[model samples]
Target: MNHLKKCLASLALSLGLAVSSAAAQEAQKIKMGVMQWETIAMTSSVTEHLLERHGFEVEEVEFQEWGVAFAALGKGDVDVLISHPDYAAADYWERNARKLEKLSVASYGYNAGLIVPSYVTINSIDELNEHKEKFRGRIIGVEPGSGMMRQSENVVNEYGLEYEIIEGSGPVAVAELKSALDRGEWIVSMYWTPSWVFQEFDIKFLKDPKGVQEPTETYVWLAHKGFAVQNPKAREVIASVFVPESALTQMTGWVKEGASIDEAVARWEKANANRLDRQAMIGNQ
Candidate 1:
């Protein structure tokens, strides 16, 4: 009887191992590229959760620069990227247009330009010269390579404002903005819209009469060539995901304050379950 029991146990173990191997082989995997920006992180995390529910193993590849993100997509290292093709990525999109497929426009109304606290009494880019001293002749800007900073330089040159463009990171710029606001001091910084900071702080964009800044651009989901053909359900989810301006601002704001991407996504999902379901439905359709 003991010999029979041992044989039965060995047979069961072999069957179990075979089943596990089959399951692993059947599991589908998808890779997505994302930037370190709060919005990108939040969106990518939310998508990851949703895809996992549908039996897909999702991987997020982080790229510091949008340029690198595009290259990864071209090389097929990453499958998808939720990005703004018309504005910040226009140059890259132009180069990779044939290589990538735009699946859907995920969000819109992204604006980039100079901004200041509403109390600063500045209304337009041209008016910066008069209050240059009040702002300490410095325009706090995000990364030097950012399109916003480049446009800011144009604004300075076009308006002939004698201000220095202080190049710092996004977090540093936000910190400076918060400090200036706390002290009720006048300050100008290269800022944008559809950002969590806009919702967190009472700030306004300075008008640009010369149209140096482009109109609001739509952020879209770009897939590697033939990704949709290979993974229809995954494409559906990308199509289904939609983040309104308000929700995006609030969620990204949380991430800016050190919230993990998953935490922020969970919080948003708990509060917006209906919206999440709707997005899924849209994708399936």
Candidate 2:
């Protein structure tokens, strides 16, 4: 009986140690939510590298929809995510605001609206109708349910512009823009900045005078509530990360030209070692 009691006690102790070890390991791991968009992917990659360098294991959780991504972060499925909370993902952010925490601005100068090649003479959304014939009374738009598309709908109604927003995927819109530019045809498309297109083509966003759309926004870092309390060091590292719009544009351009996202981010990191070091210092503190 004494032997059996001793053995049972030993088994209980081992189980307790295993559970504690697992918890410790989990604490060192961070799950980051990533979207299919290149900008998000690039920024997420940078954050992942930074966290891993500082001794934390990073796992990227892929999400297709903004609402779903925000939901995941709120539910603790992901520790962190990069998004344009003030504009593009505002609705989602509001819905999950209570369960999430805004960490820092990941990047700035994120703008979305009707864009035209620099060669096009018109410079504002209101002017598009005046040159309807030039633009063929159409606005090339991305996926139908996208935030940008929803905003574009508001833009059309707000401005009372007589134009149709042709709904399609992002790549299709890009292709249409490229084709128009190639043929020297005037075209206006709903597009955004911090994109590879800005680096590759001479395009400009048509000015939104009435401000129906957000003229500029910042991609912010958001995390699950209590993430900071649980992982202060990781939070510091994430908060310290800030990629400029130009850098993100350049990295995205590199990715567009056959470089992998990781390769593009690696190049940026190598060139911006000083910045990375500075961020590391803050994290270490």
Candidate 3:
């Protein structure tokens, strides 16, 4: 009886080991990519979770910057992504439009542009001209490589505003705007929405009377040139995914309130079940 009991325990241990190995092998499968910006992280996380439910494991790569991300996509360092509709990103797709595959429309966007602190009496972009002296004829711009900065440069030329654009990243631009506004010193800076800037700072988008900026844009999800063929399941999940402006805004609000990326994403998934389709199944890989 003692020998039989020992034999039974050995068999159970081997079976447990086999089960663990099989589970590890199943978990080893995954999809990989980056969210081009923090704005899309939470929403994409929802898509990621939806894909996971459909039997996919996801690996996230911290997308460093727009330009680099685009270049990386072309080389296939990342497998899939969503980005705002902007010239910086447009330049990438325009160059590789034939090489990249369109997945689905993610979000539709509105007028995005430069803004000023609410305290400033300038309700219009034109006001900058009259108050040129107070501003020292200068404008703070987001990252040098950003599409908005390029547009701001054109605005200066188009409106004949005598000002120089100072280059910096989005957060730096916001910090510069807030600090300058606090001093009540005339400050003109680059701005774009779907960001935490409006939530935390007393700012308003400057009116563009000329309507030079692009309007009514839509952000999209994209995959590599031949992703659909190689990963039919990924394509299926991609097709079922898209996020709207309202959804993105809610995520940004959470970020502004000090929620981490993972936390905000988890909250968005739990709160927005209706927006996602659970029946949409990508084949089990």
* Highest lDDT model number: 2
Candidate 2 residue pairs in backbone clash: none
Candidate 2 CA-lDDT value: 0.87
lDDT of 3 by residue, 45-77 (tens): 767777778777788776767666666666777
- Per-model TM-score versus the true fold: 0.82, 0.86, 0.74
lDDT of 2 by residue, 141-176 (tens): 999888889899999999999999999988999999
Full-model lDDT for every candidate: 0.82, 0.87, 0.72
lDDT of 3: 0.72
Best by TM-score: 2
Model 2: number of backbone collisions: 0
Clashes of each: 0, 0, 1
RMSD of each: 11.4, 7.8, 12.1
Where is the poorest 10-residue window by lDDT in model 1? Answer: 18-27
Regions more than 4 Å wrong, model 3 = 1-30, 65-68, 75-77, 84-86, 118-122, 134-136, 179-186, 214-216, 229-232, 277-285
Regions of model 1 farther than 4 Å from truth: 1-27, 282-285
lDDT score, candidate 1, position 125:
87
